[model samples]
Target: MKRWIILDRDGTIIKDKNYLHDPNGAELTEGAADGLRMLAGMGYSFVVLTNQSGIGRGYFTEDEMNAVHLRVDEMLACSGVRVSGWFHCPHRPDEGCSCRKPELGLVRRAQEELGFSDADVAFVMGDKKSDLEMAEALGAPSVLLMTGYGAEEYAKGARGTLNCGNLRDAAKAIAEFEDGAARASFSRDLREHAEVVSAMRSLEAQAGAAASVIISSLRGGGRLFVCGNGGSAADAQHIAAELSGRYLAEREPLDAAALSCNSSALTAIGNDYGFDKIFSRQLEAHGRAGDALLAISTSGNSANVLEAVRAAKKMGIRTIALTGGDGGALAREAGLCVCVPSSATPRIQEMHILFGHALCGIVEKTLCR
Candidate 1:
């Protein structure tokens, strides 16, 4: 489904220059470009709906208004952001045009042109009451930013709108909301699956098996190497940090490194040998016989992660894989494969972190004693 972010141009995206028509006068509000980029990453397309009354009042030409929009687009493009649509209501307040703020003409046009019918899923964002009114008319949620005339609007009792400090904050809030919704859906689905329950029952046994190898490796004075990609990359670093520092007890730091943490080495190896070789090369340099490699992958089939696992095996390092969905190839290759039952990425990741924390806690208790 195509979700739209309907934005008010002057105060929401750029500094409000009273009736801004000159391209040179257009300046992106701080973090505006980044905010739009964040929304773009979340699959929301932007449509700027602005009220350009200056053109209607004969204060500026329609051409001048277009030039300003061009400037805005150019600025946003520098950050790899693009505005999917540009709409304007160029009529005076007294003209009684239906396309003006608080009216649904522009939104209707957008719906007809863009081929989207669901208004409830769309978001309207601006710094004025009229924008909120428009959203209400369309049955869409609205976000009011405290940017240009926002303070005055708030003082005038602009209620029933989500208020934000800036566009960046609004973007982050929306992303979080989306993620929460996804997790909720995943949780509901997981409850109906008997396999997830079965998987939970096996966690203790799996953790014990993996913990035994990890504890023996550390006791033998060998280090731990961890690697993954995307969300798993973050999990890799997080687990490595917990092990190298203290997990739940105050104790001496253990030797652990997340191969995915070094951007310089990652880029150098990727550029020189290819993306699949990045983790493998890092493992070759840091991994040794008797050490342990903790490989995290939601699918358990990422080329880079698999390569690292193979490298660890070749180096005589014990390999542990945290994976999901039948555990892919890593389950067969690794010395210990702990597979989360759910196939959904978010659910798998949640289980991966939980498993990591448990293992870290067990290791901490053993080593500290």
Candidate 2:
């Protein structure tokens, strides 16, 4: 399923200014552009729903508002992001407009134009009570950021809502959550099929074994290699980065490298040998005995990742595969396969990160202790 996100503006997008409407003076809060760009890169289509009652009160002209939005788009584009749409409710409390906050009309308008019903969005992110209530009404998850009115919202016990320090943190959480849901949902039907479920269970057991191997290797002064393609490639690098350094925690850096981080090597190898050889070649060149290679593939069938794992095994490197669906062909060829029980690519990818983080946490605690 496609993942869409509804983001609030004013307090959420730009810094809240107590009903101020000078678009010329509007500026995005810290990390807002980065947050939006990160979500866009994760395949999320964004729609901005804001209560701009300042417009209804003649504080800012519609033309001025458009100019301000254009500025926001420009900033995002500079960071390689594009907003799908923007919706604002230009009515005051006195006017009692349905499109205003505490009402779902603005979101409804966005749903109509974007062709994604309320059910399609994974989460709504904002710093206000109306934002959470709107998300609840639509049955979508909500992330409350501690920016703008977020502190107040948090103080009011926004317990069920995912809480973050800022928009960037909130966006990251939503992205992770959506990916996990995809992985879980994909494996739902297979749970009823005894054979597949048994195989998956076996795979999970193997993952525990592999985790032990990884811990032992690191304790003995070993490193890790990770690789993939496109989004999976990003995941490969992300996981490696987290383990090598830390994920929201401070600690000594571990020895890890994501072969996918080298763009020059990828292109040169792809041009000379082939895309399938990019990872395997790197593995042959860099992998050593006792090192671990983590291979991530949504379909569990990326030729490059598979080839890389093969090379790692041949080179005496321990291997772990993070895959989705029926474990695909990679399941059979791995030392251990963490097959997230989800067919949905998004969800599987999400779980892969969590698994990576969890693995990192365990490794850090066990070794550094």
Candidate 3:
């Protein structure tokens, strides 16, 4: 699925200037935050690609460049947008580094590190000819902005470039493209999964029951507890975010917690006891009667999660398990087990996200009303 849009930093994220390096001086252009907010809402991952030769020319240190990135990250963070990756070519014009813009080296590095396939990218937004040329090499579309050197680049007539007045417009176009694609993909997947609801009747009933329980607790102003490991950790946080706020729909926030959110507690527990006790220990401290624990496990056999489920049960908390095909011990541990009808890891993960999104919608519409 096309899930990412490459961005050129200077004129696209901030105003472009000759040899700009000060983080304190960095300022987001008009609609920059809103544009990013739009892309984020559509689930489009972002990556910034730029040529920062100032480092190689002794004009700025790598540390300064990182600080600039930090400032940018902070600015985006406030709006709930994250840059999945960032890349810069730190070479003089004559250095002939493969990573310099117009070369696919930096793009290749990002592809490898970020696991982005060129075939799946939708567009590259930039204010320069080099950015367009790079997008061409990767078979991705291009969006040209008329900011900074954009006028000069526009004057040169970049073939196939979608011209925009500023980054905000470009971002809007990109978000629309991504949203359309996501909806299409999601619809197709859901349709295919729908055919199996009859075969997985028991699991569906359990999921419905668990979702009803979640809606009840949330309606009563009780918080939810989520926990998992690795990718499931990300999923745990994701589900909680969707509950604590809106996923795509506008509604009042729900109270939710991911025991894994506190790094200090996790590290302390891991160090003092063991990895298996990290989540259970947190559950002991935070859980209360009637609170719900949403444990996510692809294999449904993660010992740490099983222990946490046990702890939550002991505390009289409602238990829900989001698991994959043939749920292991997690199915037994959970008061309600929603086993996604897939065994393949990727498909299971895909279903998990879809389920979480639907659950968020269900809980919000039911409780907020």
Find the candidate with the highest TM-score and give its number: 1
TM-score of 1: 0.55
Which structure among the candidates has the greatest lDDT?
A: 1
User: Model 3 reaches what TM-score against the true structure?
Assistant: 0.49
The lDDT for every candidate, in the order shown, is 0.87, 0.80, 0.84
Ranking by TM-score: 1, 2, 3
lDDT by residue (tens digit), candidate 2, 187-293: 77455443444444444555566668778777778888888888888888887888787765677888878888888998999999999999999888877898898
Per residue, candidate 1 scores C-alpha lDDT tens digits across 1-369 of 788889999889999989887899999987798889999988898888989889888999989999999999999999999997798999999999999989989888877777776553468999999999988888888998888888789889995357887889888888887788899988887774545656667678899988888898999999988889998899989999999977878889998888888889999999999999999998898778999999999998999999999999999999999999899999988988999978877678878888888889888888889
**Positional deviation of residue 297's Cα in model 3 after best superposition, in angstroms:** 33
Better of 1 and 3 by TM-score: 1
Q: Lowest-lDDT window of 10 residues in candidate 2?
A: 192-201
lDDT of 3 by residue, 172-277 (tens): 7666766787999999777766654444555556656878988877767677999999889998999999878677667777899888889999999999999999
Tell me how many residue pairs clash in candidate 3. 0
* Structural similarity to truth (TM-score) of each candidate: 0.55, 0.51, 0.49
What is the lDDT ranking, best to worst? 1, 3, 2
